[model samples]
Target: MSLETIIYIIFAGIIALLLALFQYFKKGKNRSKLDLFFSFLRFVTLFSVLLLIINPSFDQIELSIEKPSLVIAVDNSSSIKHLKQDDKTLGFVKSLKNNTELQEKFNVNIFTFGNQLREGDSIDFTDKQTNVHDAFKALSQIYKNTNAPTVLLTDGNQTFGNDYQFVTNSYKQPVYPIILGDTVSYTDLKIQQLNVNRYAYLKNEFPIETILVYNGSERVASTFVVYQGNQKVYSKPLNFSKQDNSKIIHFTLPANKVGVSAYRAEIKPIENEKNTINNIQNFAVEVINEKTNVAIVSDFPHPDLGALKKSIENNEQRSVSIVGVKEFVSKVNDFQLIILYQPNSKFKPVLENLKTLKKNYFTVIGTKTDLHFINNSNLGYRVDITNQKEDYQGVLNTNYSPFYIDDMGFESFPPLLSNYGGVQISQPIDVVLNKSVQNVTTNDPLLFTFEAEGRRQGVLLGENIWQWRAHSYLENQSFHEFDNFIGKFVQYLASNKKRSRLNIDFQSFYNGNSHVIIKAEVFDKNYVFDTREVLHITVKNKGSKTEKTFPLILKNNHYEVDLSGLEPAEYEFSLSTKNDKITKTGSFKILEYHVEQQFLNANAEKLQQLARNSSGTSYFINNANGIIKELLEDKRYVSVQKSSKNTIPLIDWKYLLGIIALSLSMEWFLRKYNGLI
Candidate 1:
């Protein structure tokens, strides 16, 4: 059966023949015929020993009847064709269309990738270049959750993303890579990346940002033009920084519109580069003019009211309203803040109703204040004055700071209050200002406050306005100080009124022939999509001039739009909504349609590595059938068998002596019958 077996047979025969010769030679010896016969028997015993050393065996093996999982991934990029129209690529694909073994073994899912990924039974490769990296990424995402082996069919031309690198990594299953069509030579230019802001200020400079490009050996300079609808807004010359690569470029273009502006950027074709179709980039920008509204409310009018109102009303953007404390109680929630002046005698009635306003209030206390409500109510902390002292005639005027508000030094100014007395602050008062004059007695508390649960209140103990408002050297600048204290507080609260920022996430596929549905999430304040706003979307190939608009209704503040008819290409989408025009812009490169291709190829390669790593041989698809059969039959294929024989000298020869005596008896009988002694 084997070379070793054949050699053993030949050697055994030759040894037997040599034994016969020795017998013949010994028979002719007259000195010791018996000894010669015994020597011949010894030679026979040696031949038997050699036969046993060869160690022959016959084995039967059982193989697995289960079939391995098979996956098919076909390249559905634009370069691949759909029909048999005398095209080489198409012909090759058609020839393999009816592969029954492939069909029976694989649970197939077909996919195409260009600017997006599309899945289907049949697809025409779009006229777009392929990005193999994106294709692999898409496949990885799809099959990452599965444990299936894959079979990938492609042309091996990756015009877009990375390729072949995935094969270098490990996979859970074997990847059977079957390359389709012969690689060909083609020269083309592609725009690698385009970057632009979806939002910009109206009548401001808009940055036209993009990356200049070349794919193969193409070097040329071209003029790039920016178009706003049918009008050409800007044009400039651009040079390819890299002959077979890409370089970044940024230029400012004037944006004079206040709304969504449809724009396209084009580069005149060079010798090797494609025309404006692949060189142009389309996009849209939402120019925003953020508007803000402000309102002011007050209690019993005070001298500081005029100053506060003037400070805010002076700004054209701010709207100031002066409402009585009584009127504020009715519409308090309408305004940002409620400013209350020194109350009359008792504050119980006002403080009782204060809890119903549902708004933060700033209360200022004057000389003649009511202690009944302050001492009894939960809204304002109680205050008491100890020393009955008079204010200095000319006090050293310094900065007047609130408890938590910042303090800026003020020069000497006329004293607003004469014969003023400092008052004792309560435990609720968080901080205290310094006493600039000795007249600041225990009778008057400069600043004190009461903080309610869920509501904030600021109470100024002493009201001396004429000095700080009129005589201060910063003349009209005290407004900044007053505004800062109130501004930060109100703005901070307003910001917290809404929840996290809005964001949407989703996935899509584009087969070169069919349009992939474009879907995304629409998140709003509190995830409540009740704005009824209209979301406008503009989609364009990354570097191609072809562009399309898709409008969706922001229902319940969430949106999902579909773009059903489109060819495979690299696309960038710009989104804008009516309320907030500057929305989200996303870029997605579609993958060629292929099923199981990536996984099978990845798995096959892994299986090959497994075999090699373990001192086994890798097999191809054509060889898998026979190789598996052979491996299953050979037990050595699973593991090496340790030799069971051991050599040693034995003293037990009783059985051999018995056999020798029986043979001698038979020989003697034969010799006696032949009439020989």
Candidate 2:
């Protein structure tokens, strides 16, 4: 307590004593043992009340020891069971969790990871995919800014995410990896990867690329074959040794029939090969008879025109032709979709022709675009533009429902240049991307789509989209994602299908390991999205002649059904509404491919490198005991003693108020009993 508080307390006591004395011995009052007792009660009551008014506070100190965190991350992917190490992985984790000394020294937190990270020790080892990078990412967030040492139990054969070896630097904790699976090397021939387009034109040859790898020192000869059902369509002899262990095979196959076609690529395994499951791979492609032809009409040449053409034509079922405004007017009817690039006064004839013919077109606006011309053209939207140009980045509109599109890291893409303006859409539209300037998002649409009368139209309020394609390639080292996005946009505008009450979105083919989810949207008579309607899907396996039905659960703005439990085969499904007779039917094929079962042995080198980068050691399953001893001996992970101090006020103590009341009550009773009121 401070000196001021001490002085106040002393004065309070002196005043109480003086009052007690005056009450007991004033003038003619007689003094007795009872009087003394009454005086004592008054002194206590008055002094306590005064002390409460002062409300002096004292300091209290508390000490506590905070133990360091010990995270145990187990890989629960199917690769562990494929390698015959599930039981060993489980036993190691159980023993580690039950260790008394380690538990007492550190806070033990256990987690299991397959495609994602989950807390706890429930290990059934039935996960279909492995993503070690995501597991570390989650752990880094859970144990950030703490002394947490992680013990990773896995076979180090990741099949579903970014390379875990490259992401070790992101996590600051020490990672001791317990390597599972056999370390012995075996002569193996496997098909590493296969790439083919999702769709092919009927009667055309579709290209296929296959990468073959051998993992043995000795020379080996094998036959690579491509099969459709039970018949072999193509074959080649392949030779591999230590120096030439990899080969890239590229070929084309004729798509004679128009439907979902499943094919298998196999590299015949050598004799005595232990793991032959990886020698064969399955893929599928859909053949369609229709093709979308797009024409780009521009007054002058620009890189954006080329980029759009390449992206749209990436799908084998689409083709693009670029022409000048005058030339396009002659061949306007030849193409299904028209792309008007920065339309100005010279393109007035082309725009009028498109409107008259009721043809769908995509308008791309930029600095060269004439806003006055657009305002008078009656394209369902108008933009009030100024002389200044603005650089606007793209922000994805997650609620867009016209069709499904992935984010594809749009936030990191470079900005596009456009005239400074406010856009006003006169009709109902769905915005795929909104405008963001300097990181602040606006309500204006950057890329949007709308339907008028019986025709569909798409608009982009900016140019320089070529930069987006380039940036996408730089980030992912591929242009497939960017191309697929543009292809979907073109596909929507090229089709002449009218608006329907029931719409379903799904792919024609799916890999066995992928999630088979179908989304549906139902509309009422007035064409408004109806959420009260119940939806159901009836699926029939074409090969097995089995049928199953499932109810579609209502989501935020659509209905969804997960068909992941269905086995790999050709399926024909029909979606119907519960109250109405509206139904939509489609067929899709599921290829038989399990990425987790392709590994022959553990990826020991990469795991060792990961351990070295994180300042930890790598050990085999048999010698995993060393990890416990090492963690116990590590000096950096120790308990820290922390102290805290608090100042508590005297009035805050509830018992002081009780004591004051009791003393006052007792004094009043004594006075009343003695007839001294």
Error of 2 at 294 (Å): 2.8
Q: Pick by TM-score: which candidate is best?
A: 2
How many angstroms is residue 424 displaced in model 1 relative to the true structure, after the best TM-score fit? 36
Clashes of 1: 54
- Model 1 residue 30 CA deviation in Å: 99
Candidate 2 lDDT over residue span 442-480, tens digit each:
999999999888899999999999999999899877899
Worst 10 residues of 2 by lDDT: 24-33
Worst 10 residues of 1 by lDDT: 395-404
What lDDT is reached at residue 169 by model 1?
52
Global lDDT of each candidate: 0.50, 0.90
Error of 2 at 561 (Å): 3.4
Cα misplacement distance, residue 288 of candidate 1 (Å) = 2.0
Winner by lDDT: 2
Candidate 1 lands at a TM-score of: 0.36
